[model samples]
Target: MRRRARELAMRALFAHTQGGVDLEEALRHALEEMGGEDDPYGDPLDEEGVAFARRLLFGYKAHQEEVDRVLKETVEGWDFGQMSKTDLTVLRLAAYEMLHEPTPFAPLIEVAVKIAKRYGGEHSGAFVNGVLGRLFRRIQEGEVKAAPKED
Candidate 1:
């Protein structure tokens, strides 16, 4: 159920990125498309899951410039523009979750890796893992600074 929610969120993000839809609007639209209020399992699209997705989308949207800057700095010679839309979306979502939110890292990274493997090409999982691993190390090493300056 949680996995399905993430996949739905990713799909919505991809559609938004590819189609230029507003993020919240896109999410609401995604909720609708995914059966919206009728979300049989309870909690109206699983409040926790949809909220998680919304949090991811908002964080990524808010910090996209910084995120892209990090990606540019980290991925040598690989222009962000050159990345596949799906790969880029996955990377952004994973990086945001891993770096910004209070969620545990390993499982989120694992989800991203698995999603990449399932949705992207042969090299996508390795590619996402390598990039996310770099991001994780940067955070652990105090290289990638957090917002609001955690004490």
Candidate 2:
């Protein structure tokens, strides 16, 4: 159920991002359409899972510029415009989490790859993994701090 919530969040993000609608409204609309507590994809996520998705969305919105900067800085050759929106949204969300959340890199990376494979281009899983893995290593080596210290 949590997974489904993540996927749903991803889907909504893809919609807002690619469609260029207001992201928050688009996400809310998408979640509403995804069906209720008995959603067929799985048991509707519990409140915790739903809340997590919202938290992720808010975080993504709050720090998207920084996340995109990190992606542009970390990815060697690929430009943001050259990437698929699915891949971009997935990376943006993961990048925000990497910077702000205490979630471990391994599971976070796994989830990002899963999201990419499920929603992005065929190469998105590997692409996201490669980029995010490098960032994770930099963080581990103390070469980078999440988003600089918050004031």
Candidate 3:
């Protein structure tokens, strides 16, 4: 159920981002569509899981410039500007979790790959996996901070 909600959120975010709508407004719209004051998932998600997705969404929005810079720099020869809006947004969201969230790298990477496969290009899973694998290693090695201080 939570996964479904996440997918919905991702899809909405992707649409808004690609269409150049305001991100915070888009998120607020997502929250409202999902039942602003209600438990929209039906099943109760653990606080950790709910928080994980929310943090990923907020962090992605908050640090979009930096995130895109990393994407631009790390993708080497891959033009993110030319990618599908859906693919780019999914990549950004998963990259946010992979780099910024307090979860383990492996699980985050796996989830990202799955999302790419489910919603992106035929080879998007591998593409996302490769990018995130290298990025995760850099973070683990202290070459980069997953994200700036979450203040």
Best by TM-score: 2
Error of 1 at 49 (Å): 1.0
Task: List lDDT for all candidates, in order.
Answer: 0.76, 0.79, 0.68
Model 1 Cα lDDT, one tens digit per residue, 21-52: 87778887877767545554333467887877
Clashing pairs in 3: none
lDDT of 2 by residue, 50-106 (tens): 788888888888888877887788888889888888888888888888888767777
List the candidates ranked by TM-score, beginning with the highest.
2, 1, 3
Candidate scoring better on TM-score of 2 and 3: 2
Looking at candidate 1, the ten consecutive residues that score lowest on lDDT are 35-44
* Per-residue error (Å), model 2, residue 81: 0.8
**Clash-forming residue pairs, model 2:** none
- As for candidate 1, its clashing pairs are none
Off by over 4 Å in 3: 28-52, 147-151
TM-score for each predicted model, relative to the true structure: 0.81, 0.85, 0.73
How well does model 1 score by local distance difference test?
0.76
Per-residue error (Å), model 1, residue 67: 1.7
**Candidate 2 error regions (>4 Å):** 35-40, 147-151
